[model samples]
Target: MSAAKPTIAVVDYGMGNLRSVTKALEHVADGRAHITLTAQPEVVRAADKVVFPGQGAMKDCMAGLLESGLKDAVLEAAANKPFFGVCVGAQLLLDHSEEGDTPALGLYAGQVKRFPDGLSDAAGARLKVPHMGWNEVWQTARHPLFAGVADGSRFYFVHSYYMAPADAALSLGYAEYPFAFSAVIGRDNVFATQFHPEKSAAAGLKLLENFIAWDGQR
Candidate 1:
């Protein structure tokens, strides 16, 4: 008999484009796993793997997690299961965010800060805030989720703030807007990306594919 497929939870905290996240996972899973886009704590906690996805405002993200009562479940999964965080979902894992002065889940010790003013590129042109569009991510450390992905692969990004972990060892990848910033961060079973892997086309799909197969180590 074949083994049962894993149940992967795409945490729907009422902030992100859940359909896109879910579709991406479903595409990658290819029937090897069950993808659940849910706001229920029980569903999140019962899943074999968890994906925390976020967008919009930090205050709203936090509020949605509380309102949906999925915060504790997400924390539990991050601590013990294979968890992946994307965009604002990634930021919320930090200690705090300059966006709305919001306090985060504190699973990782760090702050999420906005891009400073007067930022200029190498040619000295002004760089835009939110850091929209595509940017190349320079992987800083080896992790199972990075399998089959090149070191400096470009990923889709749309955020004004970036995670700055207290421990530099937690940095998984770096990308530059004008200066290098944490593009990916992880430790243990938890992995996160400032970029939306769902929107990153081939490279991003590859990442999601890897996460589905990852054992949550390193």
Candidate 2:
């Protein structure tokens, strides 16, 4: 008998860019996995894995989450199954965000803050806000999600704020700006990234493939 395909629930909290994420996951899985973009609490709870991808301000995202009554459902899913968060969705896993002074899901430690001087070289030229375009990510720790990925690979990035986890050990990847910041993070069954894996091309697709193959046991 064939093994059951994992159902990935891409949470739709009104703040996420779900279309691209859904398309990317579908492409990576080659139709082997079931992907759903939904705002229903029951749908999230029933999925084998959950993905929270967002693009927007911290305050607005949190507000949508609460108003939808999907916050508790998300926490429950993360506690019991494999969970992934991207960009602002990943930032929301922390205790709080300096953006709009909003409280987060507190699933992980530390806080989120904006890039002080924006991206800068050693000489200190302003690289601009939003931190748009592609950047290299240096893998810092071993995780199943990075199974076939190389140490230094370029991924698509577009964000202004970054996360500072209470425990550096939880960090899986780093990228340089004026200084290095956490690029990917994983702890137990939860995984997150500051970059957009959907937009990262082949390397990003590999990451998604690993997530789909994960059994959530380790």
Candidate 3:
């Protein structure tokens, strides 16, 4: 008998850019899995895998999750299933964010911080606050998610604040924005990225494929 198809839930808490995230997952699923964009708490609880993708302010995102009653569902998935977080979804896993001084889900250790004011690159040219465009992401640890991704493969990025995990051991990848910052992180059944793998083209797709196949044991 064929194995049951895994249901991957893309949580819809009303804050993130969900269209691209949902479409990207669908494309990568390729009949190997079922992807659902759900706002219902029960549906999230039942899924085999969860993709928590978010875009915009940390305060609003947390508010939406709380009002929708999806926070607990997300916490349950993180503790018990193959969970993936993208962008702000990744940030929410941390203890808190400096953005509006928002409190996070506290799933991951450490705090989210904004890029310091008066920052400049090596050339002394002021770096943009919202770090945009494509940048090289260096794999810092071994995990199934980066099976085919090269060590210094470039990925798409769009964020201003970054998460600074208290434990460096949680980091899986780092990218340099004229300096080093974490780009990927994983712990137990959970994995997350500051860069959008969906927007990352070939390398990103490979990572998604790996996630789809991963059994979450690691």
Candidate 4:
């Protein structure tokens, strides 16, 4: 008899791009694991791994978590199992977000900060807000989830606020938008990315592939 496959939960709190995140996971999972898009806390807590994804305003995201009663589940999963956060999901893992003076899950000690105005690149050209499009993510340390992914590889990004962990040692990856910003943050079983790996191409797929195989170790 074969062993039962691991269960990977994609948390749905009515804010994230669920279909894209789910599809991406399914693509990489390829029957190695069972991927579920769920709002039920019981299902989430019972899963072997959890993927928390979000987008749009921080206020709405928090409100949705409360409305759906999945906030505690997320916290529990992050504390006890492998957790992967994407975009606003990554931001929510921190203590707070300036996006609406909103409080978050506090999974990590940090703040989500907005990009300052009057920004300019090296050529002195004005940079846009939201920082849309693809950007290279530079690895800060060797990690299991980062396995097989090259340093300085580009990933898709579309956000104004960036993650700023209180402990600089928690910073695992960085990307520049005129200046350096936190693109990935993690410790132990929790890992997060500000960019959308599902929307990114080959590099993104590789990252997802790595996550499926990761054992949540340092």
**Worst window of 10 by summed lDDT in candidate 2:** 1-10
Report every candidate's CA lDDT. 0.92, 0.89, 0.90, 0.92
In model 4, what is the error at residue 71, expressed in angstroms?
0.5
TM-score of structure candidate 1: 0.97
Worst 10 residues of 4 by lDDT: 1-10
What would the per-residue lDDT of candidate 2 be over residues 58-108, giving only the tens digit for each residue?
A: 999999999999999999987888898999989999999999999999988
Look at candidate 2 and give me any clashing residue pairs: none
Cα shift from native, residue 76, model 3 (Å): 0.5
How do the residues 1-218 of candidate 3 rate in per-residue lDDT, one tens digit apiece? 11357999999999887988888888988988899999999999988899999999999999999999999999999999899999999999999999999999999788888877787888899888799989998888888888988999989999999979999999899987767888998898899999998999999988888888888866
lDDT of 1 by residue, 78-126 (tens): 9998999999999999999999999999998999998998899999899
* Candidate 1: segments with Cα more than 4 A from true spot: 1-4
Which candidate do you rate higher for TM-score, 2 or 3? 3
Comparing 1 and 3 on TM-score, the stronger one? 1
